[model samples]
Target: MKSFRRHTESHRTDSIGWLRAAVLGANDGIVSTASLLVGVAAAGASPGTLLVTGVAGLVAGAMSMAAGEYVSVYSQADTEAADLSRERSELEADPVAETRELTAIYVGRGLEPALAQQVATQLMAHDALGAHARDELGISEAFTAKPVQAALASAASFAVGAALPLGIAWLAPAASLMVWVGLTSLLFLALLGAVAARVGGASMAVGAWRVTFWGALAMVITAGVGRLFGAVV
Candidate 1:
């Protein structure tokens, strides 16, 4: 019995749900807020105006992330529920056919036909719905959509990420506010990317470069537009 006991181990898949939400929220918050501030500063916006704009961006971005994540994740959850419901009906209406489907799935996965049939029958006997949901539908608890969790995570991470540039903008001199916010935001994004990559078991440098590149591009374009508009005005 002791030898048969299962040992626990953690995998990156376990954190997939929250990790994705956090990374996206944080990246968007930083990039958007920083770009906004830099663009405004380039347009010769006063310090007071910059701070106000940053604060407003932070609030709006956080709320947007929360609502967006909730609706998107809810849609996924709804789809999954519908699928499970349909699967349940099939299970109840024609269990024999369902069993054959399961057996065929196992056969496709390299199991012998006789062994696949036996395995499928035993699994269905144990928990028909669960087995079908996992193997047939590719739905499991780890991948199950949780709208509330996703929304909260996105909102919280977005606020946190937005605060970095906002704080820097508040403290930095007005003469160089754009440079300060832009440089520091890139640093923040690099760190965010590296940390996210590390957690997700990817190349830190690659992730960092990927995020920083996009952020830089956004800031540059926004600043250019602001400069152009300011000169025109």
Candidate 2:
């Protein structure tokens, strides 16, 4: 007889929480900082001034991302905690009702009534709170919020993404700083989108185009505004 091996496949759903924060942070970091630099350069700012603006943007943006991510995710965590607490209270107050509720949930999902009841009963026996939390409340470990992790990921990724444009602006010639920053920032945005899509099992082209289009539009608008204001001043 031959032995058979079973293989398990991993899905990106597990990465939904942190991946979203990281990608958003990085994308915003690149687009916003680059646009700011291009705008200032268009407004006749010196290279030293551009560098100062870029550095300031990088620091501010990273901290903002981190703080925003933490607060938003912490809100979610609080909601989940409240829900779990309510569920626990309900379970303690009325075990039969909780069991029936869980059983009904399983039955609604296509399980036979008797089998669902049995399964729910066994699960509750093993861990009533866990079973209710997982099934009745739709709260699972996979989607649990980690505020600290999200904040750290956002801050770090934002800093890294913002650095690319800052470095380019620093190295490129003053006369053509705008061009270099704009083009390189687009490249970075496209790359970020492609990599994020690939990691999430989506189309690379679509992601790349989506981000680049917005980035280009933002920079163009900012540069135009800068030129207009520079003329006025």
Index of the highest-TM-score prediction: 1
TM-score of each: 0.97, 0.94
Model 2 over residues 1-233: C-alpha lDDT tens digits? Answer: 99878756667988888899899999999999999999999899999999999999999999999999999999999999999999889988999999999999999999999999999999999999999888877888778999999999999999999999999999999988999999999999999999999999999999999999999999999999999998898
- What is each predicted model's overall lDDT from 0 to 1? 0.95, 0.94
The segments of candidate 2 whose C-alpha lies over 4 angstroms from its true place after superposition are: 1-9
- What is the alpha-carbon lDDT for the whole of candidate 2? 0.94
Model 1 residue 161 lDDT score: 92
Instruction: List pairs with backbone clashes in candidate 2.
Output: none
Summarize candidate 1's per-residue lDDT along 14-111 as a digit string, tens digits: 88999999999999999999999998888888899889999999999999999999999999999999999999999999999999999999999999
Q: TM-score of model 1 relative to the true fold?
A: 0.97
